[model samples]
Target: MSFFVSDRAPANRVSGYKRRIVLYCLGALLLLLVAVAMGAAIGETAIPLDVIGKTVANRIFGAGYTLDPIEEGIVWSYRISRAIVAASCGAALAVSGAVLQSLLRNPLADPYLLGLSAGASTGAVLVTVIGIGGGMVSLSVGAFWGAALAFGLVALLAKAAGGGVSAQGTGQIILAGIAGSQLFNALTSFIITRSANAEQARGIMFWLLGNLSGVRWDDVWLAVPVAVGGVAVCIWHMRALDAFAFGADSAASLGIPVRRVQVVLIAITALMTAVMVSLVGSIGFVGLVIPHAARFLVGVRHGRLLPVTALTGAVFLVIADIVSRTAIPGQVVPIGVITALVGAPGFALILIRGRRMR
Candidate 1:
């Protein structure tokens, strides 16, 4: 009689894989720090490297240092806020992208394609063109609602199509998102065409393209909480996200209660995405493209994939923002434009490769 024994080799292989992933993540994190420092140092005013060093040190440690008031003001106020927004928006978009891709089981999935960004842009454009908000904060709130409405509509449509959240055939949901995006985009164009104010028109136009300028500290407060909460929600559902890799039925067989978990997961992602898009306008490509890149690096396991994607995204955007500001001295290019230029080609390549595979 032969006794069956459990194999330990597979477990060891898994352990080795995890170790390599950890080491890669550490290296990525260090690169992210370098990217951030470069972003902070090389902006419009060109803050000295020493000044950048000192300001960061001051913020990181409670250490005392001296600098000219003008230099201190520039580093602490203008440059830092923009850089922080850059990183925050990057991480938020990246993680949101990862969540959306996993939810839909499609690499092409992104926040804007799902209509969240366009919807939010429409709401905020109305405010910008009509001068609805007496204050900046109120306008952000308007954008948030618009974004939330778009998200809701998509969710409703997905449920109607027999895949409320857990259904793995994402073709229907993706089509719905595209339709929703077009609807909102047309509405936004209508608003812009009817507007009487040129300044408002320009502002609305710029916002739609996406930018990191005109950002103040108050915007950070709004963006940070939503992003953090979204990340937390995603982390909690990492296992569920992993289950999605094999499609919904496989997940349900594994006792994941696919439908219920999916609705909650999508809802959380939509909320977080709306807030970020509303704050920064429709920054495209980062959410869609970054996750695919991360997957290539770390595979599709959401446990490791999510955080790595987030960090890579943050690094990408920070570098993008730096280029936007400094690429031409007088013109502050919109951050969204930069991301699109970088992300669109990669997306097209992914689509082509996916088609070939099919």
Candidate 2:
């Protein structure tokens, strides 16, 4: 596998690199475990860490001290599901962002930048306004189709601009993505405006802003498959992502199979985006910010970057959820809102740093 490992020291330096990778992976794993525990422990009712651990153990193996039905329900039904949702969505968005930045060869590439979120929102909005499923599955399906359409349109437009399905410059793709996003976003707004119910309008608006409240195990089932599949696809095409970083022609010359891989990645990303957005509306800075943060931690190897990005994303989302719920008394902010506030400034800093480096 001629893929970039992000940390590629010479053979003589292999031992040191190996140690670093192991430690990094271990640290990320520890962070994930802590985040999960902490996320489960900090809801409105406030389960202690020991209780949280006991609840998890009981749920997993029936070996720990048992709680009453109410406590069990809170732990099993509310906190665990919520924590899982946070971890899954965060990991999915972060990895998606990382893959997108590499694939687009632009630091700013994200689900929104590629119109996947908007497209998925369009589909989801269609079902919501028109009435799709009575439940989460129906919503997820609608969002999936919306994302597919958005990404499909962007891909087609990019192809047309370059005279074929080839990787154009970052500028072309980003511009095309922006155009696609605007078109879909407009369509979504139109749908909301035409809706007869005020509640529906509010729902649509909240969905766009993103939230992880009311998460159920059903949402977990819907999100996990898509996230896992997308991660697998990214791993398989790690080399292609690296090739893309050097530019399309360079990737092609290196036998990276640019167009085919590009299509595959876009499809994977679109599906994952739809799943995520449907479950938790349009969480913005996650895809934009977490990848860069994780990259700084893990260097830039896709093998390492892919996993670490996912882990950091999970941690970031969990912490964000904690703050969203606990930052104010008797009030909970939307997770997406918190992430954007946190992400946007740091993202700007990254851009400034990039410019300075140049």
Candidate 3:
């Protein structure tokens, strides 16, 4: 009997791949659970871990636990919801960043690359400052529509500028996004400067800087589904992301429809970014910082990179949220502020590492 060495090698490789995937999934799940638990248990008012666990069981599984109504209410109503939204938002933005980076081949590419943040800010300002919706639309709805409008404008600009999906076209899209961002940002500033009262200006500014104070169960419901779907879509197209990272010509040669994949993935990322921005305001640093961190750890293969990036981001933002609440006693800093504080330094480190690698 001859030993089939060739077959053994292929089978072994397949086994290793499956093992890596399983290990990654389990590790990510464990860390995420721990981070969520930490966020729920530690805050301005600390809730006991047992109480939180019991409250979650009672609320989610109908576990009969004789717990304080106040503790249960806090756990079920505010903290848990906030933690869930933070995780969802962080995961969405980070995955969007990773996808954009791979697709655009720009280390700096982020969910806001297509002017979503600027547009959302302008839209929120329009609703709050200009009263465009006349109290009919909430800030979240206005911001979301604004983001959608911005995405459309950017796409039109990129196409009209004569860059389809070539390497040159990648730069074209980035330029178009920059121009659109400037226009919307200017509009937001103008409205705030000319129309908004001090209180209104303050409120919009805080929201634009990112605030999770108002996150509730409704937000969790909205954010969780969007995050899950967007991430699933990205994972499903993992091959396309890797292909795009090489070049459009290469992706096309590989039978990947370059333009279609580009458009669909960008739209999905925009939706993820827009929804998260709507829920939590325009949180910065997450989309820009998390992907690079993930890439540094996992290398360039998107199959491994995407999920690690998302989990890292989820944990990072949950921790950031905790810091924002606890950094200054009795005063909740903007979540954006905490992220910026960490991200700016992290960005510098990434640059240093990149230069060294070069």
Candidate 4:
């Protein structure tokens, strides 16, 4: 009688795949840690990396590292908070961009493609310059309501224009987003001009350009959860998002419940974008450029694309924030300025390569 032997090659392959994924995850986490440390160490005060580490350790785990109070305060209270917020903001925007680009079937789709950022700006200006909230509602609260209003208007217009979740519907949504953005931007400008106060204009315009200087631990609490939750929600719909590549009809044919998936994901995107914009102002390019870069690196598979895109966006924005702080001798530039400088060229390259492939 021959002894039966079991084949374990398939098991080995499965184990190998799991090991590879773990390696990728570990590598990404290490990179993020290094980037965050750099963000804390290389700022205006130039804290040492060891001090940054000790501060973090002392704060998180009570390591008792006996660091200087000033250094610890700077790292723990200021730089670390800003860096983490940058990471959170970047991840949220990038995930939103990927979702919008997939759902809308538009290469240029971004978080602000729904007019959320513009409406948030309008709302913040109304509260700040026009005093619509009468010193009661905060800037973030006004921005959220404004974003909700703009989304409602855009939804109605898109529904009227195309009537269903079809190919035409995506196009109408884009057009509606553009129209809503223009309207809200005009409103923001009108309110600012009515105020006619250069100081307020200067301050709010700087914030509108994208400012992270005001970020703190409280902002971190708001930002990190939204980014993590947004990514988790997107990952849950990875299969549906992949099916969406062939258009709504194809997605529906694949049992995707196209309309429901679209609505849920779009709402998630809007919520993530509104929260981040309210926290950090409207920084561009993280959402628009990072997804294309991830797609280029990982191909078009959403399962692999979403997490990688979020990590890349987080690292890129942390670096951008660093640049914004140190790009000049004694002045901090708006984070948007740095992102635009990098993203414009990056997007041009993506378009050129895409055309060549076509």
Candidate 5:
């Protein structure tokens, strides 16, 4: 005598799914704004959020809002620049991770895992120590070349190992990447030890561990555009990335030029990584961990996944940078250390979850 209840239709289900995606994106954006504010406001000297807003408004609009020079310097010059750089680097690394994971169809794939960071680091070190390209050369230029070299080597090695940007070839590529990273890292260590003095070594060590202490507007200008552009490019290629999730054969059958897409995406990733590493020196884990965390929230669709991952990474790293500066009263911990401490545990959880799913 009971009446059957009406079932939800497919259109309704799709609408509901989209609603959830929108909500997730909005939430992430809100969190990112809060994190940015916190990062700008909380530091060695704790500028208020109101002061931050006034300083920003005054700068943009030439409003007559006035603050002490020290407050202005702390809020406008230092904290804001550092936060922006952290956000840019985080977004770049996360986007690179998402691209790499999709390209390789391997959960653990990241820009650093592919040797880009080590290569860039080597290039920067060479420039710093040996004065490569004469004294006029910038570290960013060296990093760009270094990253390109590493990428080329990894591709060559992968090709020799019979890995041609396909899922079946992922293991070979990973091994090649590991080898390339070790080789570059060894070269970097040797150069530092052989050439750099103790003071120079200390500076290099801090940079290698990832420092944001000296980030200025110039760094913000350098990093933000590249990161934003890179993210845009990845989003434009979301369809190809989606095809890649199914493997090369399937992607090719779906009319995606698998090799071409792989090459382009890998180049973009390397470019972004090099830019960030050049500015901040090789911060890790954002690329390795953020994509997986985003996937948990947004599913595997790159449209939703990429934006969420980028936003989450921006928020995560800004907060991490805040902790790095404030954690020790008289000393600033390297941003990399905080990320590793946070990311390692998160990574372990991901491993446990993956095992359970399998």
Candidate 6:
């Protein structure tokens, strides 16, 4: 009886762990819905949650419900688009963060740390200020190219520094990323200062600080596929990610293609970051903070971590966007500002607690 009890205890513990993960995921989904509803309902002119539901239903399923033109425009055009973009961007950034932390073996690693955002900013600034792409190429295209370029340079520098995406090379990669970020950021500033007029520079500055007010269905469509695809790729590589947690040598011994997996995951993260940055500018800290919070809630296994991270990120950004719009009457704060204000303190707390644990 005692021997059977030991086996049963282990099985019971495993079951309990799985049950908790499922419960957390379910809770996250519910919170995401509530966040979306709250985002739609809390603007200058409030629309009830019921109206938001009806509006969405009517638009999607031809339900027999209606609203005034202004209300319809607010719900369908402005708020919904903003909410969707926020959710998508949040999820993309957070997942990128989670992957990077595992891939780099550094909990502090985030998407922007690799200079993607800076490169994207430089691209957008060039397009807006100097019209480098002429009228044919769009800002989004410029940003994507910028992000790709930045990633290439970072990888090059990291390789040159003797790390080259191996587990032992994480520190070199971080250093390269820092150098690239500074260089690109300076280039962005130079472009804005030298080429953009006062008014144009102001607009670029606003965009760089992260504005979601102008997001539309077009932006949402551009973001959703990239976000979904990147996340799916991450999930497919979950076992590889778990292996990497024990270091590249461990992963290799486990028959993982360490170098190839690292490159692929990094590329996926860069693509996700590029699309989101192009759509919403550089909204920081969602990547840095959300993944950490999700990891705390769901543990480190990518199987549980990724989905919960995505859901938490979406809900967090939606709520953040809502606060950005409503925090100051008659003026919308930049979403980046709000995130920084919230994330900086939370991150510091994480660092403090992490140090204490040591």
In angstroms, give how far residue 355 of model 1 lies from its true place.
7.3
lDDT of 5 by residue, 246-329 (tens): 888899899998777877888788889988988888788999999999988889999989998899889889999999999999
- C-alpha lDDT of all candidate models, in order: 0.79, 0.80, 0.91, 0.90, 0.87, 0.90
Error of 4 at 283 (Å): 0.9
lDDT tens digits by residue: candidate 4, 249-346? 89888888888888899999999999988888989988999999999999888999999999999999999999999999688899999999999999
What tens digits encode model 3's per-residue C-alpha lDDT throughout 251-305? 8999998888887888899999999998899889899999999888988888888
lDDT of 1 by residue, 157-247 (tens): 8668876554653666787788888888898888888874788778778877887777767877777777767777887899988988888
Cα lDDT tens digits, model 6, 13-121, are 9999999878876887788778878888888788988889988998899997957768877998999888988998999999999999999988889999899999999
- Count clashing residue pairs per candidate: 0, 5, 0, 0, 0, 0
CA shift of 79, model 1, Å? 1.5
Give the range where candidate 3 is weakest over 10 consecutive residues by summed lDDT: 163-172
Q: Which one wins on TM-score?
A: 4
Cα lDDT of candidate 3 equals 0.91
TM-score of 5: 0.90
Task: Indicate the worst ten consecutive residues by lDDT in candidate 2.
Answer: 1-10
RMSD of each: 4.0, 5.1, 1.8, 1.7, 3.8, 2.9
User: Which is the winner by lDDT between candidate 1 and candidate 3?
Assistant: 3
Query: Would you list the clashing residue pairs of candidate 6?
Result: none
What are the runs in model 5 whose C-alpha is more than 4 Å off?
A: 1-28, 163-169
Q: TM per model?
A: 0.86, 0.88, 0.95, 0.96, 0.90, 0.92
Q: Alpha-carbon error at 346 in model 4, in Å?
A: 0.9
Q: Quantify how close model 4 is to the true structure by its C-alpha RMSD in Å.
A: 1.7
The pairs that clash in candidate 5 are none
Q: Which portions of model 2 miss their true places by more than 4 Å? A: 1-23, 132-137, 163-165, 169-172
- Candidate no. 1 TM-score: 0.86
